[model samples]
Target: MDFTSEKKEAENNKNTTNGNNPQEIVDSSSQLSVADGNNSISKEADEFRERQARDLKAGLHPLKSKFVFWYTRRTPGVRNQTSYEDNIKKIVDFSTVEGFWVCYCHLARPSSLPIPTDLHLFKEGIRPLWEDSANCNGGKWIIRFKKVVSGRFWEDLVLALVGDQLDYGENICGAVLSIRFNEDILSVWNRNASDNQAVMALRDSIKRHLKLPHSYVMEYKPHNASLRDNSSYRNTWLRG
Candidate 1:
């Protein structure tokens, strides 16, 4: 709740509704147990969160997995002489909930991001591309929400993921969110395209965390198909 240092630093860039401190964007929606306060974190949550309080008192919070966040934006009437990967920026990697918040707080929010921009948070060392070995055998579950409502869903999904609340073990690769001109899209990526049990569990976890009914529909797509057709967002496969 206190970002005095961030407030002072962001004062010069005070263009956002939160008055320049990007950290404020997550205040209403931060789902990380470390951010949600002690009482709100149930004992059944991930072990990372179980230890977050003690770690925080010692100025550190360790997590079971590491994640890297990336950002990219498309510009109109601008032909950049650089590869798409070259344009993509690797924001930072976090091995703890607190560290994740520190990096995320300074980044632009999905609602305020430029049109045609994506926010990718993947397991450390795994590039957010289908071609990566870690993702080649994986697929993502795409969910759609209005731009204004997507932020909260995005928050919960990321927390459930990094916190290992999905109970999928290491099968989860990462998640991505696309902020487009029309609507927003959020996807949960897992390392397996054929593990029905694990995949179903992840799907159900997502639904439960977002408090959606079992009938709330979403589609799963394999990276192999994307590689075959050179598409990223296309979901020809479906899984309930």
Candidate 2:
């Protein structure tokens, strides 16, 4: 769809609330605190790593790199970075195909998630925030899909990411599935927004992997722009 059509769809869905408000930003410091805490989280990480090593030794297919699944549910009125970080939780990380499915199967699908919730699958060391060193100079390509097809689309993108199907896979940092009242958003983030060749290649890879139609609208938003505006989905440049 064109920008005008996409805008209209967004407006139409504005009143279709899922008993939730909009989302908030995230913080990196809070993530560090969680890692430093002396709790089950630390124990869980140690056990997870041990199991991952065992799986690899047992011949589980290893992925190009490790990835972490992050989850965050935003309060209706809290929008600051600190609150966002506090809300963000590290779900789990996986380094093998089998490990990925083990984690994915236990989680609720995007369609079942409440509004204003986000499921972020990023590289092990990269936080979902725009301020992350790997993401600070980069941007994301976002595609909004109807709620009915959102789950399938999200799974497709996740598989493509872990399966190394993207031509510019090295440039990709991660993908996010944002569950909202209006629509579900799927975004692929890259490491360098200034590399036009890599950016366009990543976009093309998404289209090919998702088999999106010619008229489907996609958006590009630089991390710097999000940092300046304190918004993730606003002021995006439309592309298809």
Candidate 3:
């Protein structure tokens, strides 16, 4: 079975809508004041993002956090690729929006990647491993999509994550995009799994940011569960 043909057919489905809109995610609440320093922070977050966008507009873009991008691919005939960690390579670290876009433009999009490839965009200090101390207590929210829409979905979510539009308030660690044969899974990792409030907030924010309908489903899985399974991509526990 030539999955690439299936991928092309999937791309033609056109279920993915145009969602690169920032205003759709960040609302007028972004204008609220932070007088007591405890007021609604959606405004502050919006302000911060506006500033960042302005910086990017002026060719001076910088983000609140530094992020490292990693790439992993399974080679068909390469004996050098032994383990998941073996094929993984740290690509580049970007702190600015311009810098990220430069890399993004040069790299292949999710739809262009071969099956079994994965991309990791984690905070500079945190590796994308589930066992990493920074992620040990955290969990991931997985959004699965068909190849047709997954590429756009991945890009929009990455922008939101880096822009801090999700507004989980620093509870987020980073995000991962896993490309597979039948589908692609985009998951956001946070710092605390037990923090149900934070998890749900982030989940809802993702749905809102992507402007997804109520019927869409997002899956949550703890890092601890991944440890026992030995593979982040399959066979573990699922929390709604």
Cα TM-score per model: 0.72, 0.77, 0.70
Task: Provide the overall lDDT of each model, using Cα atoms, as 2-decimal numbers.
Answer: 0.70, 0.77, 0.70
In the range 187-237, model 1's lDDT, one tens digit per residue, is 888899999888888887788888865655788889899778766677559
Whole-model lDDT, model 3: 0.70
Model 3 ranges off by over 4 Å: 1-59, 75-82, 233-240
- How well does candidate 1 match the true structure in TM-score terms? 0.72
Where does candidate 1 have its weakest 10-residue lDDT segment? 17-26
RMSD of each: 9.7, 12.0, 12.7
Model 1: residue 15 alpha-carbon error in angstroms: 17
Residue pairs clashing in model 3 are: 30-43
Best by lDDT: 2
Report the number of clashing residue pairs per model. Answer: 0, 1, 1
List model 3 lDDT by residue over 82-142, tens digit each: 4665766776666665555544444556766677777888877788777777899998888
Error of 2 at 50 (Å): 13
**For model 2, the run of ten residues with the poorest summed lDDT:** 24-33
- List runs of model 1 lying over 4 Å from the truth: 1-58, 75-82, 213-215
